[model samples]
Target: TDFEKEIKGDMLSSFISEVRELVLDNCKSNDGKIEGLTAEFVNLEFLSLINVGLISVSNLPKLPKLKKLELSDNRICGGLDMLAEKLPNLTHLNLSGNKLKDISTLEPLKKLECLKSLDLFNCEVTNLNDYRESVFKLLPQLTYLDGYDREDREAPDSDAEVDGVDEEEEDEGE
Candidate 1:
């Protein structure tokens, strides 16, 4: 029975706003993972997980009060459809660095009308011309686009090549 009140939990309900922005540079893996963050915090405004091995985030209850969310890096693949249905209050989302061959898997997030910022860095994103147009066509509230930036990392194109994007430019950008 090593379980006791050795550590007292903080009350997130009293917080004026719950904005958990976890921005790390480089986190290799989630080996030996432990308990997840209990978001009982009513004031939770923002939540970010940068450079962390966050594979799957299940049971994301409705956060009508949430404003911003940033989750970059780590080996997260699949189940994006489910994620889009949840987390309605997210305004800013950064999904950079991961194994994303097809971004269409994440189109579900377009339902988030409050979404403003979106980042998809080094995600093997193909068909940005099509994808970008699709997103712009769908999500009317989006403001800042991430991949189209000149400083964005270059992804290898297959047979066809889009203007304003070249292998040489990608090298410089990356």
Candidate 2:
């Protein structure tokens, strides 16, 4: 199909004029890579490249307004640093079901202050020790991790701590 061939080639740059959101899922991209494609969408805010078999995220043009990106179920091994550097306004990212193994690969994300939500649900990195705590410490601005909110965890802890400490200790004093 021309559409498939166009998407697989650098021809995308010619079509995208003012596209804000683009979804190119399951394209079975050649070489499992996406290069020189993103540069076309100048006004792109959201991009979903799910299940595209992408192995790298290089040659991506800086998208200042990009807020959300979905690269789930791809072969992406690394390049979070590039993502963090290029998309400063990115707030949500889904890298689930990938080949990512080391949590340190996410260290670059600390610089992304606007990033609030990250989903690494089925990635191998999720098996690391203290994954949640480590991620929270690295990116404190993140209110959500793997779908769980910081407020949700803190709220229950505060309630349990107050009840256990004040009520239990006061009762024991009497």
Q: Specify the highest-TM-score model's number.
A: 2
Root-mean-square deviation of every model: 10.1, 9.9
- The global Cα lDDT (0 to 1) of model 1 is 0.57
Highest-lDDT candidate:
2
lDDT string, candidate 2, 49-144, tens digits: 899878876645678888888989988778778887789988888999998898788888888888878889899989999888888888888877
On a 0 to 1 TM-score scale, where does candidate 2 land against the true structure? 0.73
Clashing residue pairs in candidate 1, if any? 18-43, 18-44, 18-45, 19-46
Q: Which portions of model 1 miss their true places by more than 4 Å? A: 1-36, 59-62, 126-129, 147-174
Q: Stretches of candidate 2 above 4 Å error? A: 1-15, 32-36, 151-174
lDDT, candidate 1, 1-174, per-residue tens: 233333223333334235444233454434513234445544566665666676755544445566766667756664566555557777667777866666566667777767766666767663466766555656666655573423344423322333334445334554
- TM-score of each model, in listed order: 0.61, 0.73
For model 1, the run of ten residues with the poorest summed lDDT: 155-164
